[model samples]
Target: MKKILYLLLLVSIMTSCGEYNKILKSTDYEAKYEYAKNAFEKKKYTQAYTLLEELVTIFKGTDKAEESLYLLARSHYLNKDYETSGQYFTHYYTHYPKGQYTELARFYAGYGYYLNSPEAKLDQSGTYKAIDEMQRFLDYFPHSERAKEAQDVIFELQDKLVYKELLNSQLYYNLGNYMGNNYQSAVITAQNAIKEYPYSKYKEALSMIILKAKFQEASQSVYEKKADRFRDVIDEYYSFINDYPDGPNAKEAKDIFRVANKYVKE
Candidate 1:
């Protein structure tokens, strides 16, 4: 019985392959379209993409154009060619506007970029593009079933951007007074990140970096500037403690504040 089943499966595979090869060489566009749809449904994305790639252009002014274009984008997406899929999806929505697949095209275009977003330490152009596309999806489809998911992706991408900035700020802080006043640059970077993403998960970390940077800056200042610089550290320490009394860096912040306080008068 198992042998019979195996034989049947072999025959089925051979027949399917034969039919696919015939379709691949056929000149009948309608036959290619139907086979492509079936191929896509069966998860044969490469075959579907090949057929749909040609049909999308061939059927440009025909009734099948919209579906062919959308299927082409979906085929690339399913094949994990997210960058190409994103471009095709963008093309579909721009040309169709009100086509049947516009909503999905917009959603996937952004989601494709989201899927393709690189590590935080890498270049973040893709992350930025993902956020922009997802925001546009939200603007156009506020009540979509995917709206909440899109918003979540946007927040996650924003977090990645914040993380990159945090790394840059830390790098600057670590370079304190080697050649230039990097502590000040660290403070600026952290402060700007805080202002730009007030609700980021990295907000506390950024604030802590600012406080640390200010403390380091004060500690390395000239004798004539020491008192005023220490005052700045004290103020920053207060701000940090007020926001996060029990934060991970609270103890470290307190240690800096203790040293900074000796320079300030009552």
Candidate 2:
């Protein structure tokens, strides 16, 4: 009887062990999820992106779907696929607005756009978009822990845009007639640059461009028309003084204004 009982207990232990092994294999959801995580932990970003994407798709509608979506976005981000990562974050935010990870999604979406901003010499449309998105994040999540980081990014992007505008204006000025066939375009470009980037350090240079362009335009005018054109130069000089009362250019602008006013039309 003891032998019989011992045999039954051994069978029970063996059955339980087999069932547990089956549980390990059949519950592929966690295994797949872990596999992707392990790859990410090992810094295999590309592999992680692929595996996580697959895991999310297959596990759609499961309890872990939200987590899978978040992980998928992170995988793409870790792989430096900022455009794709941004898209996924946007998708996540739209689908799960109140999810636990919603704030993270918004932050990553804004950050992705920030990271994707083109070089300073290129068009700043993307940079402006980043700034707008980040500002929106701050406005919506004012009390969020990520608010300070978002503000910092917005400031940095704004600085980049200001710098870009200044460079463009200066380039137009340096290129002279080669940049545009007429002085009007150059003057207009410089003026617009100043208006667009009021905080830029290159305001003086922009003022100089406008002043020089107007002077040249006035000099090229014909007969009595020259006086009318010279008046435009004088007006611009005054405008410069009004905007910059104490800068290094202020005195220079005043001198130019004095000289330019003498040529004004009656």
lDDT of each: 0.94, 0.77
Please report how far candidate 1 places residue 11 from its true position, in Å.
5.6
- C-alpha RMSD in Å of predicted model 2 compared with the true structure: 10.7
Clashing pairs in 1: none
Candidate 2: Cα lDDT at 164: 73
**What lDDT, from 0 to 1, does candidate 2 have?**
0.77
Which tens-of-lDDT digit does each residue in 1-266 have in candidate 2? Answer: 99999999999989855744563355476876776677678776775666677677778887577887887888888778888988888888888888878889889888989999998999888898788778878877999988988988987887787667657666665676674545677677777776876776677777777887787777766877788888888878777778778887777777777777777635
Count of backbone collisions in candidate 2: 0
Per-candidate RMSD, Å: 1.9, 10.7
Q: Which residue segments of model 1 deviate by more than 4 Å?
A: 1-14
The TM-scores of all predictions, comma-separated, are 0.94, 0.76
